[model samples]
Target chain A: MVVDKMLYNLGRYVNLLRDAIARPEKFSMYYKETMRQMDAIGVGSVFIVLLISVFIGMVTAVQFVDQLGDSFVPSYYIGYIVRDITIIEMAPTITCLVLAGKVGSNLAAEIGGMRQKEHIDAMEIMGVNTAAYLIMPKIIAAVVVIPMLVAIAAFVSIVGGYVSTVLPGSLSHTEYVLGLRSFFVPRYVFMMFVKAAVFAYLITSVSCYMGYYAKGGSIELGEASTNAVVVSSVLILVFDFLIALLLT
Target chain B: MIRTENITKTFGDNDVLKGISTEFYAGKPNLIIGSSGAGKTVLLKLLIGLFKPTSGKVYYDDVDLFSVDDDALREVRMKLGMLFQGNALFDSMTVGENIRFPMDMFTNRTLGEKEKRVDECLEMVNMEGINDRFPSEVSGGMQKRVGIARAMVLEPKYLFCDEPNSGLDPKTAILIDELICDLTNRNNITTVINTHDMNSVMGIGDNIVLLKDGHLVWQGDKSQVLESEEAVLQDFIFASPFLRRLREDALKQRHAHD
Candidate 1:
C-alpha cells in the first residue's frame, strides 16, 4: 500500500514537472521573475552560506592539526586535506544541504500559500499556466545561482582553513600555501559544479512539487514545507553519493 | 450562453452534484444559490471546467468544455475571469501589478496601454488611484473591488464570482452586486455568481438555480421567487419563521388586492 501510494505521488510529481518545464508564454515575464528569484535565492542566502562555510573550514583545519600531532605526516597536509575535502565534498554538499533547509522550505511555503489562497486557481482561470509561471523561474534561478554559491563556498572554506591555521601560528603560512598548491585537480572543481547543479535542480523541483499540489490548510502547508526540506536534504545526499561514485 | 447537460460529480462516496442541466444566459447576472452542502460550489466549478463531471457535458456556447483539447481549452479559458471568495490578490504585488498580471502573461500590449487599461478597470470598480497599495494594505471590501478589477482587466467574456459578497458589509455587498450587474448588462457578458447572500439573491438574481443535496431543485428569476409553489424554494428562502410569516402576509395581500 505504501509503495502504491508512493508510485501515485511519483507519477503526479512527474506530470506536474512536465507541465512546469514547458516553453514559457512570454520571455520578458519569465525573465523578470527569474531575476527576482535570483536575488532572493542567491543574494539572500550569501551571508548564511559564507558563515557556515567559514566554520566548516575552521573546524576541519583545527581537527586535522590536533590529529597530526607528532606524526610523520607534514603540517602542510592540513591545507591539502582541507582544500580537497572542501572542493571534493563539503562545498557543494554542505552548502546545498543548508539551502535545502532554508530556500527549499521557503519555496514550499510560498507556493503552498498561493495554493491555499486560491491564487493558483485565479491564475489558471486567467489563462496563465500556473505551474510554469510559478515553478520555472525558481528552477532557472537556482540552477544559475546555486553553482555560483558552491564556488564561493569552496573558495571561502580554503581561506577559512588558512585563517585558522596560519593566523594561530599552528602551521606556517608558506607550508599551508604549499599544501593547497599540491594535488590540485581541475576535475574536482568540475565535480563540485556538477554536484551543485544536480542538487540545485533537486531542491527547487522537489520544493515546488510539495507546494504546487499541497492541499488543506495551514497545517498542511507546514507539513509541505517540512517535507520539502527533508526530501530535498535526503535526495541531495543520495545524489551526492551517486555523482561522486560516477565522476570518480 | 453556457449550458450543462446532466452534469454530476462524486468525491469518494459523496455525490456532491447529481445530474444537473442548466443554461446561464449572457447580458444578465445568473446566480447559483442553495443551503450549505447543496452542491452550489460544485456545480459552479463544473460549469467553469474547473471540475469535470462524472457523466455529463458542459457547452460554452457551442464548444464542449470536456471534449476539447488543452489548446482549445486554454483558448476558451482566455475569455474567462473569476473572482474568488478570498479575493486571491497577490499580496506581494501592488494593486496595479495584480491587475496587469494577466495582460503581462498573455498579451504583448505596451506598458502604457496596460496601465491605461488598469486605471480603467479600477475606475469601473469605483476605485481610482490606490494602484500602488499592496493587497494587505487594503480593507476587505477594497480587496474585493481590486479582485473584480483584476478579473475584468482583460475584458473577459465570461465572468465567474464565487461568493463575491461572502465577507462584506451589506452596503458593500449591494455595491458589488450593482457593479457586477452593470458590467454584465453593459458588456453583454455571461456572469455566473455563486452566492448565499439573500440581498444578492433578491437584488440581482436575473436567473437563479437552487440546489438541495446535490440536486438542482428549483430554477427561476427573482420575480418567480415569491410566487413559485416549489416547497423546497419556499422552505429555503423563508426558512426563518419571521420571513415565512412575512411571505404569507405578502401572499395574502396580493390575493386580496387581486
Candidate 2:
C-alpha cells in the first residue's frame, strides 16, 4: 500500500513538472520572479553553507591526521583526503541536505500558505497558469545557484584543511600544497557538478509538489512543510547514490 | 449569463450537491444564500470551473464550460474574475502591484497604461492612493476592498464572489454589498455572489437561490422573501428569534391593512 501511494505521488509529481515548465505567459514576469528566487535561495544561503563547509574540512583533517600517526601514510595525505572528500562528497551532499531543510521547508510553507489563503485559486480564475507561475522560477533558480554554492563550499573546505593542519604545525604548508596539487582529476569536478544539479532539482521540485497540493488549514500547511523537507532530504540521499554510481 | 443543468457533486459517499440547476443573469447581483453545509460554496466553485461536477453542464452564455479543451478553457477564464472568501490578496505585493498583476500576465499594455488601469480600479473601490502598502499593513475591510479592486482590474465580463461579507461588521458588509451592486450595474457584467448574510440578501439580491442539504429548496428575490411561505426559506432567513418576531410584526401589519 505504501509503495502504491509512493508510485501515485511520483507520477503526479512528474506531471506537475511538465506543466510547470511550459512556456511562460510573459517572459518579463517569469524573469523577474526567477531573479527574486535566485536572491532568496542563493544569496540568503551563503553564510550557513560557508559555516558548515569550514567545520567539515576541519574535522576531516584532524581525524585523518590522528588515524595516520606512526603509520606508513604521510601526514600530507590529510590535504588530499580533505580535497577529494570535500569536492566529491561533502560539498554537494551536505550543502544540499542543509538546503533541503532551509529552502525546501521555506518554499513549501510559502506555497502552502498561498494555497490555504486561496491565492492560487484566484490566479487560476484570472487565467494565469498557477503551476508554472509559482513553481518554475523556484526550480530554475535553484538549479542555477546551488551548483555555484557547492563550488564555493569545495574551495572553502580546502582552505579550512590548510588552516587546521599547516597552521597547527602538523604538516608543512609546502607539503600540504603538494598534496592538494597531486591527484587532481578533472572528472571529479564534473561528478561534483552533476550531483549538485541533481540534488538541487530534487529538493526544489519535491518541495514545490508537496506545497502545491497542500490542503486544509495551518496544521496542514505545517505538515506540508515538514513533508517537503523529509521527502527532499531522502530523495537527495537516494539520488546522491545513483549519481555516484552512474557518473563515476 | 451563466446557467447550470442538473449539477451533482459527490465526494466519496457524501453527496455535497444533489441534482440542482440555476441561472445567474447579467447586470444584477445574483445571490446564493443558504445555511452552513448547504453546498453554496461547492456550487459556486463548480460554476467557476474550479471544481467539476460529477454530472452536469455549465454554460457561460452559449459556451459549454466543462466541454472545452485546455486552451479554450483558459480563454474563457480570461473573461472571469473572482473574489475569494479570505480576500486572497498576495501578501508579498503592494496594493498597486496586486491590481496590476493580471494585466502584467495577460496584457501587452505598457507600464503607463497598466498603472493608469490600476489607479482607475483603486478609485472605483474608493481606495485612492496608499498604493505602496502591503496587504498585511491594511485592515480586513481594506483587504476585502483591495481584493475587489484586483478582481475588477481587468473589467472582467463575469464576476464571482465567495462569502464577500464574511468577516466584516454589519455596516461595512452593507457598504461592500452596495459596492458590488454598483459595479455589476455599471459594468453590466454577470455577477454571482455566495453569502449567508441576510443584510446582503435584502440589500442587493435581485435574484436569490436557497439550498439546504445539497437540495435547491427555494428560489426568489428580496421582495418575495417576506411573502413566500416556503418553510425552508422561512426557517433559514428568520432563524433567529428577533428576526422571526420582526417577520410576525410585518405580517400583522400587512393583515391589518388588508
Candidate 3:
C-alpha cells in the first residue's frame, strides 16, 4: 500500500511539474512565493540550528579526545575530525533532519490549510496555475537555502568543537588548526553541498505532496503535517546512505 | 451557456452523479438544489470543468471542455469565476490584493490600474476602506463579500458559485443572492449557483435544477418550483423549517459575535 501510494504521489508530482513548465508566468509567481516560504523556514530555523550545532560539536570533540588518547592520534586531530565529519556527513544530514522537523511540518500545515479552505481549488477555478504558484516557490526556496544552512552548521560545529577540545587540555589550539588544515579535500566539501541540495528537495517536495493532497479539516491537516515530516526524514536518511555509498 | 450530456461521476462503486444531464443558460442565476449528499456540488464542479465527468461531456458554448488540451482548458477557465463554499479568500493577501489576484495573473495592467480595478470590485460588494486588512480580520459575511469581489474581478464570462450563502446570516445571504443575480443580469454573464438554501431558491433562482440520488429530478423556474406537487421536493422544502429557523438564529448569533 505504501509503495503504491508513493508511486501515485510520484505521478502527481510529475503532473504538477508539467503544469508548471506549461505556464511560465505561473513560474514567476512560484519563485516569489517559494522565496517567501524559504525565508520563513530557513531564517526562522537559525536559532535552533545554532543550539544543536553547538551541542553536537562539544559532544563529538569531547568523545573523540577521550577515546583517541595522546599517542595514537594527537588531540590536534579533533579539529580535523570535526571539520571532516561536519563537511562530509553530520552537517548536511543533521540540518536536513532538523528542517524536516521544522520547515517540512510547517509546509504541510500551510498547504493543508489551503486545501481544507478550498483556497487551492479557488486558484484552479480562477484559471491560476496552482502548482506553479504554490509548490514551485517552495521548491526553489529549499534548493537555494539548505546549502547555506549546512555551511553555517559546519562552520559553527567546527568552532564549537575546537572550543571544547582545545580548552580542556586534550589538544593545544595550534595543533588543532594544523590537523584541521593537513588533509583538506575539496571533493568532500562538494559532495556535502550536493547532499544538502538533494536533501532539501526531498524535504520540501515530499512535504508539499502530502500537504497538497490533504483533505477534511484541521484534524486532517495536523495528521498530514506529521506524516510529511516522518516520511521526508526517513527518505532523507535512505538517500543519505545511498549517496554516501556511491561517493565512497 | 453551459451544457452537460450524460454526466456521471463514480467513486469506487458509489455513483455520486448518475448520468445526469442539464443545461444552464446565460444572463441569469441558474441554481442546483438538492438534499445533502445529492451530488449538487459534484454537478457544479463538472459544469465548471474542475472535475472531469466519469463518462460524459461538458460543453461551454461549442467547445467540449474535456476534449481540449490543458492549455485550452485553462484558457476556458480564465474566462470563468467561482465563489467557493468557505469564501476561499487568500489568507496571506489583504482584501484588495485578493481582488486584484486574477488581474495580476492574466493582465498586463499597471499597478495603478490594478489598484483602481480592485477598488471598483470592493465597492461593488460594498466593501470599502478595508483593502489592507487580511481575511482573518474580517467577519465571515465580509469575507464572503471579498470572495465575491475577487470572483467578479475578472469580468468573467462564466460565474460559478458553490454555497455562497452557506455560512452567512439570512440578511447577508439574501444580500449575496441579490448581488449575484444583479451582477448576472448587469453583466449578462452565465451564472451557475449550487445551493440548498430555500431562500436563495425563491430569491434568485431564475432557473432551477433539482437533483435526487445522483439524477436530475426536476428543472424549472421558481413558479414551477412553487406550483410543482413533487413529493420529494415538497418533503425537502417543508421538512427543514425548524432547521432553517435554527440557522437564522445561529446567523444572528454570528452577526452579534462579529
Identify the candidate with maximal TM-score: 1
Which residue pairs clash in candidate 2?
none
TM-score of each: 0.99, 0.98, 0.93
**Of 1 and 3, which scores higher on DockQ?**
1
Kindly give the stretch of ten consecutive residues in candidate 2 chain B with the minimal lDDT sum.
B69-78
Error of 2 at B127 (Å): 0.9
Cα deviation at B43, candidate 2, in Å, is 0.6
Model 3 agreement with the true structure over A1-248: per-residue lDDT tens digits: 99998788889877866665555554445556767877887798888888888778888888888788755776667788888988898889998999999999999898888988888998888877777777777887888888988889888988888888788777798988987897899989998998999999999888987898898878899899999999999999999999999887
Candidate 1 chain A: 10-residue stretch with minimal lDDT: A122-131
Q: Which lDDT tens digits does candidate 1 get at residues B34-72?
A: 999999888888877778899999999999999998778
Off-target runs (Cα >4 Å) in candidate 2 are B255-258
Q: List runs of model 1 lying over 4 Å from the truth.
A: none
Q: What TM-score does model 3 achieve against the real structure? A: 0.93
The candidate 3 chain A region of ten consecutive residues with least summed lDDT is A20-29
Ranking by DockQ: 2, 1, 3
